[model samples]
Target: MIRLFKVKEKQREIAENANGRAPVKKQSAGELRLHKDISELNLPKTTTIAFPNGKDDLMNFEVTIRPDEGYYRGGMFVFTFQVSPVYPHEAPKVKCKTKVYHPNIDLEGSVCLNILREDWKPVLNINTIVYGLHHLFTEPNYEDPLNHEAAAVLRDNPKMFESNVRRAMSGGYVGQTHFTRCTC
Candidate 1:
């Protein structure tokens, strides 16, 4: 049965070559789903998506979020998403490309989001993840944190946390760590 399908595929390729047209590459199921999700995306005005590798390579892309409200307001954060070929079934690997001073994001750019971890389900789409990231900016959770120091400050002294965030966003030193300017 598999041989039969291969023969047919070869014939189709021959026909295309004879017609002076390149054979079309078959898209994986994950790619098809990603394309659909991207097409139906309803991104917020403060967020934008880019294909740094070009539109043809949809598996890898960048999402930039410029929160207009909350502690992260006016700060630009960039995240990189790498969707596996098994997509939907396996959550996309997301990494924060911009260093942010938040409880949920560590200095090394590791994001601590429930949806990106154990809470992730196949039913969740790219839109859900984007919104989840945006929510993190608007409401940084101190309860479940990746940066314990930031979380402690946010939990113990909200004012100090705000000050640290401002300093980090302005390309100043927060504690012993120096953060590059991310304010837009």
Candidate 2:
């Protein structure tokens, strides 16, 4: 019975090739869901998504955010997203490609968003994550910080924090650490 099924499958492939049509490639459930998410995406004006590996490879992509307000105003930040095969069942792995001097983002590019970690739920979609990242720039949370120094500055002295953000964004040094220019 198994051999009969294999022969039938081979015949189908041959028939497809004969008709100048390629055999259909089966997609995983995660891919299907990701496609749906991408198709339904309604990104903010300051946010843009790009597929570095091309549109055919939607599993990995990048999102760039240019905040028009807040301390990060006129600065451009890029983040990379790597979606797992399990998709909604597991949250996508996100890392900042741009080094930013913000409380919620570490020097190593790890983001400190609740939804990306403990608060993540299967019900959440890519849009939610994108908005969350955008909100981080507009309202950086000092309480839940990935960079303690930046957080302390933000909490202890708002003015100094703003200064540090400006310096870092302009490719200057914030203490011993230097950041590249991300201003747009």
Candidate 3:
């Protein structure tokens, strides 16, 4: 039975080459799901997604968010998303591309978003994650944080925390960590 299947595949490949066209690669289940999610995306005006690896590679992409309000207002933040081949079943790996002073995002780009971790469900799509990230900027939660120091500052001294965020976003030093300017 396996031999018969292999013979049929070989015949199909030959026929594809005879047409002077490359054999089409079948999309993985994860890739198919990601394609559907992207096609149905309804991103907000403050958000934009880019395929830095080009249109051919959808698995790796960048999402830039510019919050219109809150402590992160006027600041542009970039996050990189790496969708796995088993997506929907597995949460996409998200990292902060822009180093910013935020409780939820650490210096190493590791994000502390719940959906990307413990709370992730198959029903959630890329749009849900994007909105969650945007919500982080608008309302950073100090209760759960990746950057402990930032979280402490936010929880203890809201004023100082806001000041540090501004300084960091302007390409300045926030407690010895030099952040790139992300304001537009």
Report clashes for each candidate as comma-separated counts. 0, 0, 0
| Per-residue C-alpha lDDT of model 1 across residues 1-184, encoded as one tens digit per residue | 9999999999977988997877678999999999999999999999999999999999999999999999999999999999999888888999999988999999888999898999998889999999999999999999999999999999999999999999999999998899999999
The whole-model lDDT of each prediction reads 0.95, 0.95, 0.95
For model 2, residues 19-115, the per-residue Cα lDDT tens digits are 7877777888888999999999999999999999998899999999999999999999999999998988999999999999999999999999999
Query: Which ranking of candidates, highest TM-score first?
Result: 2, 1, 3
RMSD to truth, every model: 3.2, 2.2, 2.7
**Candidate 2 stretches greater than 4 Å from native:** 1-10
Clashing pairs in 1: none
lDDT of 2 at 34: 93
Which ranges in model 1 have alpha carbons more than 4 Å from their true place? 1-12
Model 2 lDDT vs. the true structure?
0.95
Q: How far off is residue 119 in model 1, in Å?
A: 1.1
Winner on TM-score (2 vs 3): 2
As a TM-score, model 2 comes out at: 0.93
